[model samples]
Structures are given as C-alpha cells and as structure tokens.
Target: MRGPDPWAAPPPPAPGGATGLGGAGSGPGAGRPVSWGREILAGAVVMAAVAAAVGPVLGLLWERLAPRVRLLVGGDALYLENPESQQAIAGDGTFLLLGLGVGLAAGVGVFLLRRRSGVAETAGLALGAGLGAVLAWRLGELLEPDRDEIRELARRLGDGAVIDAPLELNALGALIGPAFGALLAHFLCMALWGPRDPVRRPPVFPRWG
Candidate 1:
C-alpha cells in the first residue's frame, strides 16, 4: 500500500445524506412549536377593541332613529300624552333593529377579513357586541334630554304641559339582538361556503380475466 497522505481531503458524505442530529438537512424552524393560547387571546382583544369603537356611532344613530315619547307634567307627576301611544315599544324596536343590522355588518366584515374564523373570533364578537350595545345605550341616553332637566322644565311649564321625553330602551331582552345577529351571520356563512380540507383516497382498479 502507498504511504498515507497527510493532506488528503476527507471522504465525501454518504449518498443518503446525514440522518443524525445536527445533520446537514436539519433546521431550527423545521419543528418549531406554536402558542395558540396567546394567539387566541391577542386576536380576541384586538377584535373586541375594534368592535367597541363603533359604540359612539351606534348611540348617535339610536338617538336619531328612536321614537320620542311625549309626557304631560301634572301636579308633581308626569303622565304619557297618549296612553295608547306605542312610542315606548317602538323605541325598543328601533334599537333592536339597529343593533341587528350593526351586528350583521360586523360579522360579515370580520368573516371577509378573516376567512379562517375560530373560537377566538366568535367569542370576541359576542362579548364585543354586548359591550358595544351597553355603551350605545348609555351614550344614547346621555345625548338625549336629561330626566332631571326635564323634570325641572316640567315644573316651570306647570300643569297641563306637554313635552317630549328622552329616548329610552325599555325592553331589556332586546339587548340580545346584536349578539344573535352576529352569530347568525357567522354560522350562515360557515354553513354556506366555508372551506374544508380535501379528502385523499387511493385509486381503485378493476381486475380483468
């Protein structure tokens, strides 16, 4: 055999390539883990914040669209101008309709922006809808005439006086409108055209004699 060569290059790697840890094909990002909880929490917070921002606008709309109830101040007591008037019920109906429309719009917007809807988004929408509705309720009340101020005005106007009352929401149950509408829209979209993974199957062949 020839004498060993001190400067000979190392042998080439195997054809199958490296198979052990730290191999040539290995990479840091190959199996990195994901923190889904954090992702969900962050996503929920962002969605809720965005939804809540619409409260002021909703309040303004409610104030404009809700029917006003007329009051007749008499002998330190107030009474409805028309006992048969449906203005009170109509006020609740207006709020409900407005809430439903807003919630549906929100749901469609969210779905369009994030086609991959998940639990985080759904929870956020429901929570945000309730919060926004509450905010709108309070804001709408504030925008209208104050009850105390009205009472004072009634005192000045004296008995047999008629004045328009502040816009108010009487049916507590109507608050559910936004949440119901949002969920409805979301489920409808999901049922109609949501994405699904393709199923894979082996091909079949018929035998011939």
Candidate 2:
C-alpha cells in the first residue's frame, strides 16, 4: 500500500467529542452573534405592515358577505320591511366572522414566518390585527350604499315600495374579534409547538469530557 499522497486534503474534524456523536446540541447557529433588539423591532414592524395590508381584502369580503336589511317606504318615512328580521345582526356577525378568520390567518402566518418568535413580533401581530380590523370595518361601511343614495332611492320609489337597506355593523364590539383571534392563535401555537426554551440552546460543539 502506498503512503498518503503529500497534497491530499485532510479529513474534516468529527462533530462530537471523543464520547462519540453527542446528543443533539445547539446546531451550527449557537456561536453566531445576533442583535435581538433590532431583530425583534424589525420583525414587529414588518408583521404590522403585512397584516395591515391584508385589511382591504377583509373589507371586500365583509362588504360582499354582510347582510342588508330590507326597508319599506310608507308615508314620509321608511320602516323595516320586517321588524323582526335579523339582517342587521347578521351584518355584524359577518364582519366578526371575517375578522376572526383574517386574524387567525395572520397569526398562523406570523408564526410560520417567524419560527422563533419574539415578544415584539407578537405585539406587532396584535397591533396590526386590530388596525386591520378597524380598516376593514370602515372600508366595508364605505362600500355600502351611501345613506344619501338610499334615501334618494326611497324617495324615488315612492310609497309602498321596498328597497334593500344599507349594510351596517351595529355591534362596535365586534371589532375586537380580529385582535382576540390573533392573540388566541398565537398563544396556542406557542404553547403547543414552540421551543421549550427559546432563549437557550446547547453548544454547537461538544466539550471534551
């Protein structure tokens, strides 16, 4: 057998200590330096922006899905076509449903995007979700038939005529749906599968015993 060639490259150093391949340690990232403060702030800002941008989609969905009340024009005023109709309530419910769904989606998205989540990031998620919900609420209302237009329609239609009422969110409290949903989802994810000790990790290389 010939001796090793002079120029041959040496073998790579083994991963573990002499104790053999050590149990899983902090992988290759343990030694790298990280600016956690900056990272957390940046992550929060990014999440907020992304979450806020989704507001329009929520608004559009709310507008399309919300129920409109039916009104009857009689004499000098209009009255509900059916006084007991739940359409008004349904509008608020629709907005709430949409908000919750959007919030859940946002939470899952943030969790997936930030595998190692930070407090600032979580806060940002909530803040963004709240803002998004507000935006959606306002935008949805704006998309509905304007009060002036509805009145004009009622006037033009004259007495004994029925018209679709503008969609309205009677429950202002429904706005919390998005924020509550986001927080709940985020909490669940963190509790169920997040790292046991996010701030701690084993060393990348095992120490010789």
Candidate 3:
C-alpha cells in the first residue's frame, strides 16, 4: 500500500511537539543545580553591612557601660581607664572594626570560591565568626599588656597572681571580652540577614537546521 506510507507524518506528532515522548527537552520535572558560591557571598555581604552598622553603636554603648560592667565583671582587678587607657581602648575598638571588615571580606571570598559547589551558609558564617573571634581575641591581648592602667593593676596584684583569684578572673575576662564581642556581632549578623542563593542559567544547545 505505497510502502506503508514511509513516515506517515510521524504518527500525528504525539502531543506537545518536541517535548513529547523522545523529545530533547528536559521537561517539567528536570531542574538545574543551584550554585553555592553566590549564596555564601550574599551571606557575607549581609553580615558585613550589619557589622558596619552595628559596630559603632555597640562600641559607644560598651564605652558607656564599660566602667560599671568592669566593676562587676572584673571584681578586684578592674581595668582602670585614664588617657592612655582610653587611647588603648579606642585602639581596641578600631582593631575590632578591622576584624569585622576582614571577616566580611573573607566570607565573601569563600562564597565566591565555592559558589558552584553548594557550600553551606551556616558553615561559612561559622568560619567567619570563628576567624573574627580569634582575630579580636588576639587584638585584645595585644592591647591588654600595653595599657598602663592594666600594667599598674597587674603590678599591684603581684606577679604570682593566683588563677583562682578574682584578679586572674578579671584578667581572663579582659582577654576574652573582645572575642566574645566578635562572636556576638557575627551571630547578630547571621540572625538579621538571610542566606543568599546564586543565580544560574539554563542550559542551551545549538539549533540544527
């Protein structure tokens, strides 16, 4: 019967054109993968902005409250403030801001590097927090011994200051305060800003003539 009509209009072209049956299209169920780098970068940017806004406000608040808080927190070894001490504290604040900025930049860099790999936003934040904390802690320690007030207090407390004593505890608190502050700042940023997702493009193929 005419060689079975050869192609026969492809059996009426199965509904939905090329997307039907053996068509090349991925169809409704198919989806592209999300990029991780973009998400982390977005998280970092959010954190950075938050830090920038909050740092000065917190610094001011801390400065106002430092004296009273030091009495309770430092016990017998309160970090006394004078012109030099104030200058050192100011330097410590500056160092903290620097740490925050560095943390933000690092977070963004990590996100950029790992965007395509589906990096976890929490992990990235945690890393940033940890790094910031460590940096701030080191900065605080560096500033601590340089403070003439603290040096005087240390001298008064004697070189054999017992670890179990309030003086030692106060010193420990001083060492740890900046680290804790950095952690708080990082956590606040994470809370206020949601993670970001990377933009992706759909796959394309050359059309055949």
Provide TM-scores for the models: 0.75, 0.74, 0.32
Q: After superposing candidate 1, which stretches have Cα over 4 Å from the reference?
A: 1-34, 202-209
What lDDT does the true structure give each of the candidates?
A: 0.77, 0.78, 0.42
Question: Tens-digit lDDT track for model 1 on 1-209?
Answer: 44545456655654445323444333333244556887688667746763576477678889998989999989899999999999989999998999898878777766777676677777787778777888888999999878899999999999999999988888978778777777788778877777654333443333332
Q: Each prediction's Cα RMSD?
A: 10.6, 8.4, 12.9
**lDDT (Cα, tens digit) per residue for candidate 2, span 1-209:** 55555556655545542222333343444435678888778767856674666589789999998878899999779999999998989989988888888888778777887767777778888888888888888888898889899889888989999998877778999988888888888889989978663234344443333
Model 3: per-residue Cα lDDT over 157-203, one tens digit each = 66444221111112223333433444454455544553533334453
Ten contiguous residues minimizing lDDT sum, candidate 3: 163-172
TM-score of decoy 1: 0.75
* lDDT assessment of candidate 2: 0.78
RMSD to native, candidate 1: 10.6
Clashes of 2: 0
Model 3 steric clash pairs: 36-115, 37-115, 39-196
Please give the TM-score that candidate 2 achieves against the real structure. 0.74
Q: In model 2, what are the clashing residue pairs, if there are any?
A: none
